[model samples]
Target: MTKPIRKAVFPVAGLGTRFLPATKAMPKEMLTVVDRPVIQHVVDEAKAAGIEHFIFVTGRNKGVIEDHFDNQYELEHTLADRGKTKELEALLRDLPGAGQTSFTRQQAPLGLGHAVWCAREIVGDEPFALLLPDMLHLGARPCLADMRAAYDRHGGNLVAVYEVPQDQTHQYGIVGIEPERDGAYPITAMIEKPKAGTAPSNLAISGRYILQPRIFDLLAQQERGTGGEIQLTDAMIQLSREQAFFATRFDGQIHDCGSKIGFLMANVAYALAREELAGPFRAELEAMLAKG
Candidate 1:
């Protein structure tokens, strides 16, 4: 039987150098896409996927993130005094139940692998989900929820993949897969940022993952690869040698919010996804394009 994925590790320690001035004083994960913070969206996805524990690997200036998940007593009191039941309810709705969230400091700006490794004590000896807050998935169903379903069937390490343009494969961790079987592809190779034309397949690894606990051991021993910082893909590649790795091509539009263009696109995409906002937002967008 497959061990249920009860905990999720979120690596939010990145210094969002891409966003510059805005991120200078704020963690990029706290940036808003529509009204919700990017980290909140990722947490909601994990919550929807039946994940009971949220482990955030954080950095020095990420205190705001911890506060965001906690109750604001003054704010809640003001809302109550103002008779703003709806507003109060909205805030309460998003709050995680007591003791459901945990935070650990990464301490250094190492890399994705190091951030995830920091959460090892929290995750214990179980398979867990990993979601990159920057990669926002817009779909009928949450991306990680889909991955959890796939994990139930395959019972091994699974990474969410989506097809990218062949020439653009070098920008992502590309995966080579056997033919699709029951919506899961057996991943034969995972190369982090292969050369433009040397990629084995067009399927790029999206930022969602369902990984076994053994990956922590591999990441602990992992040496720096690609960049001077340790790369999670390097450790994953090593883990694949002994365990079965599969890829699930999720159904969604992924907006890479880590980049400026991707961030702007996510705001627009998420705004258009809301029923109350979509019609007016589309009309405004059309009008702006016409003026241009």
Candidate 2:
């Protein structure tokens, strides 16, 4: 039987050098897509997927993320005093249940693998989900939830994948997969940022993952790869040799919020996703395009 994926590890330790001034003091994961922070969106996905514990691997200046998930007593009190019942309820609704969330510091800016490795103690020995906060998935269902379902069907390491333009495969961790079988593909190989025409397949590994605890062992011994940083893809590649690997092609729009264009696009996409804001937001976008 497949072990339940009860915990999720979120690597939010990256310095947002891409966002610069805005992220100078603030963690990029705290940046808002619509009204919710990036990390909150990812957490919401994990929560929807039945993940009971959230393990955030954080770095310096990420305290705001911790506070975001925790209650703000003064704010709640003000909302109550003002008779803003709806606002207060919404705030409380998002808070994780007691002891459901854990934070651990990743002292150095190593890489994705090291950040995930930092959460080994919290994740323990079970299958766990990993979601990158920067990759916002917009769809009828959360990306991680879909991955979780796939994990249930195929009990092994699974990575969410989506096709990129063949020419652009070099920009992502490309995966070679066997023919699709029941909405899942057996990942035959995973190559990190292959050269332009050297990619085995156009399917690129997205940020969502359902990994076995054994990955922690590989990450612990992982050496720096590609850009002098310990790449999670490197460890996953090594793990694939001994374990079955599969890919779930997420049926959704994934906005890469780590990039400026992607961040702006996510705000627009998420705003359009909201029923109350869609009509007006679409009109505003049309007007802006007309003016341009």
Candidate 3:
């Protein structure tokens, strides 16, 4: 019998060089979209998909991420004293319960595969979901939840993928497919950042993944691919040869918040999606655009 995927691994060890000075003192995962921090959005997505254990692969100076999930006793007490029940409730609504979250350190700037491997002890031998906080997806259903449904049906490795332009395939991990069934298809091959015009297909991997435990074994032996970093894609491709690898084309707009433009766009997109901010935010954005 296939074990249910109850745990999730979040590789958050990277230094956010792209964001520069802001990230110099703060973890990139702490950056906000709309109102909540980026990591909070990711945790909310995992929680919505019924993930029981949250394993965060952290690094030096990432203590804030840990504190974010912990109870803020002083802040909560102050809110209670001030009779700010609603604010306090909102703050506590999404924080993970004690013992539900586990933090492990990734001592070096190895790569995605290495970061994932760092959480092996916490993840144990169960299939787990992996979420990259930088890639924020906005849709009716959470991206991980959509992938979870696909995992339930297929019971193998699953990755959330979407169609990109043929020319843009080089920018992402591209997957070759067999055919489609229920918005998912059998992934024949995965090519990370394939050279221009050499890609098998334009379907690119988004940041969500539900992987089998055997992947940890493959990642253990993974070599550096593409850039000098040990890519998770390289390990996944090897796992695909021995297991059923599938990709689900999720319904959502993906915001690549790892880049400056993408981060700004995500903030705008999320703000415009909010009920309280949409009206005024849209008007101001239009006004700014009109002047530009």
Candidate 4:
């Protein structure tokens, strides 16, 4: 029987240097997209995908993230006392259960692989999902849920992939696939940021992953790649050679909230997609465009 992916590791230890002054005081994951923080959106997606344990690999000054997931007693009491049923219900809806959440500090800015390794004990020896809080995937079906369905059928390591422009292949980890089966391709090899014109395919690996525990072993000895940091893609490349690895092409739009323009676009897109905000937001946006 295939081991169920019940836990998810979120690597949010990055010092969001790109966002500068704002990120200096607060983590990029805590920045708001629409009304909810970016990390909350990722956790909600994982919950929708049936993830039971939420393990966050955070860094220094990231206490706000923990507090965000915890119950706000004072605020909840205030809302309840005022008879604001809807507000109270909304606040309580997304908070994870007491024991369902875990937080570990990465201690050093090593790399994604190192950050994931920080959650090794909590993740144990089971297949787990890894999600990057900086990437928000919006779709009719949750991105991780679709990846989980693929993982169930294939019974292997699955990486959520999406097509990127040929010129942009160098910006992501690219994969070479065998044949397309059920919207997924058996990943033959993984190339981390391939050089221009040398990429095998444009199927770029996104932030979502359903990785087996064996990967943890590989990451432990992985050598730094690219920017002198342990690259998870490098270890994954080794795992693909010895185990089953597939690339599931996700049907969604991924907004890279790590960058300024991308963060702005995420706010605009999510706002425009909301039922209550769409009409007004679009009108105001069009009015601004007309003025320009």
Candidate 5:
């Protein structure tokens, strides 16, 4: 039987240096696009994919993320007494259902692998999703939701893949693949940020992943790999050799909100997607572009 993905690990421990000054005081995951913080979008996606438990791997200054999901009884009561049910309901969506959310500290700036390893105990022995909050995926169906569907059918580890320029593949975890018809492929290998022109394929693994719990064991034995950090790709490469590893090219716009320019672009893209802000936002952006 295919194990259901009931838990999701969100690695939000990194000090987002790209948005610094602003990010200096606040956790990067708490920064908002439109009205939702980067982490909130990821949580919403996991929730939509039937994730019953939310595990946030956090660090210092990430209290706001926890606070964002906790109850504000006084505020709720005030909104209720004023007949602001719509606003109250909207606010409630951010609050994790009781017993559904948990947080743990990474306590170090290791890397993605170590960050994910921090949540191993909570994840136990079930399949789980890993979301990189810095990567925002916009779609009618959230990226995690799409991966969940793929997991339901394929029943092994799955990662979201998107085609990028060969030169740009060096910036991401490039996957070596064996075709499985249409756009799906069995990931033969995964390399972290290979030099340009040396990538096995143009397909790069984005930050979204549906992983099996056994991966924790692999991660535990993994040494400092690429980039002098415990790279998740190393553990995943080992995990792939023992079981299935697949990638699906999702139909969505993936934004690298980790970079300054990309973060600004995300704000503009999201602002343009909002009905109330679209016209004015587009006009201002167009005028700004025209001036440039």
Candidate 6:
């Protein structure tokens, strides 16, 4: 039997200093995009891609995240008593069910590599996905689903790539590929945030990935690379030689939800997508735009 790609890791350990006072009392992932928190969208995407187990690598002051996924007895009772079944169902929905989700604390700000390594025990020896909760992506199909299709066919590492401006290559992991098949490339190497005019390719690694379990061993060394933190890209590069990696262009419009402006943009974009709120939201946005 084929091993199930049932587990996923969400790295939510960042302090979210970029969001300042708003995040001071709450986790950044809890920030709402329209009516749902940013992490909820990420969780929904994972569920769409056939993921059954949710593993969160969290840090301090992240209890709210845990509470959000758990059953709220008082809230459910109020909804049931008031005959608010529709709203209650909507609110209570989306959890992965009892015993299907778990959390592990990182306990330090080591970086993405360390964050992924923290979930090592839960992940075990199965191939799984890593989703960045801070990136809000919208597509006809979920971004994780896009990568999973490629992963099942190619059977190794897959990183979602998108075309970024030449000057912005220093902001992401750029892929160097040897075209292997349709819509997939055999990764020759990866340059993590290369200097301007030195990037291997403009196809930058966005926020989604399906990685092999072998990467856990490379991350075990835990040597600090670029940015003076244990970079996940570094470990990925080391594992690329032993197997193969692919860069698949994800069909989505990604908004960096970690930044202030990006957060506002995501809210506006998502609100416009809602039927009940779209009319008012767009009218307000148009008035704001007209005034500006």
- Model 6 poorest 10 in a row by lDDT: 1-10
Per lDDT, the best of the predicted structures is 1
- What's the ranking of the predictions by lDDT, best on top? 1, 4, 2, 3, 6, 5
Provide the overall lDDT of each model, using Cα atoms, as 2-decimal numbers.
Answer: 0.93, 0.91, 0.90, 0.92, 0.88, 0.89
Candidate 6 structure quality by residue, lDDT tens digits, 1-292: 3355789999998999998898998999999998899999999999999999999999999999999999888989999999999989898777679998999999999999999999999999988999999988887788888788778777888888888888899988899888658668888879888989888889988889898898899999969976788999899988887877888886567889998898899988888778899998789989999999
lDDT of 2 at 97: 99
TM-score of each: 0.98, 0.98, 0.97, 0.98, 0.95, 0.96
Error of 2 at 171 (Å): 0.9
lDDT of 1 by residue, 1-292 (tens): 8899999999999999998899999999999999999999999999999999999999989999999999999999999999999999999999999999999999988899999999999999999999999999889999898888888988999999998988899898999999987878999899999987899999988899999999999999988875688899999999999899999887789999999999999999999999999999999999999999
* Candidate 4 per-residue C-alpha lDDT over 152-202 given as tens digits, one digit per residue, 9 for 90 to 100: 888889998889999999999999999989867898778989999999999
4 or 5, which is superior by lDDT? 4
Predicted candidate 6, C-alpha RMSD: 1.4
Which tens-of-lDDT digit does each residue in 68-143 have in candidate 5? Answer: 8999899999999999999999999777899999999999888999999999999999999999998888878888
lDDT of 3 at 259: 95
Q: Which residue pairs clash within candidate 6?
A: none
Report each candidate's C-alpha RMSD, comma-separated, in the order given: 0.9, 1.0, 1.1, 0.9, 1.6, 1.4
With a 3 Å backbone cut-off (N, CA, C), the pairs that clash in candidate 4 are none
Worst 10 residues of 3 by lDDT: 221-230
Candidate 2 residue 187 C-alpha distance from true site, Å: 0.9
Clashes of each: 0, 0, 0, 0, 0, 0
Q: Which of the predicted structures, 1 or 6, would earn the higher TM-score when compared with the native?
A: 1
How well is each residue in 200-237 modelled by candidate 2, as lDDT tens digits? 99998889999999999999889887677888998999
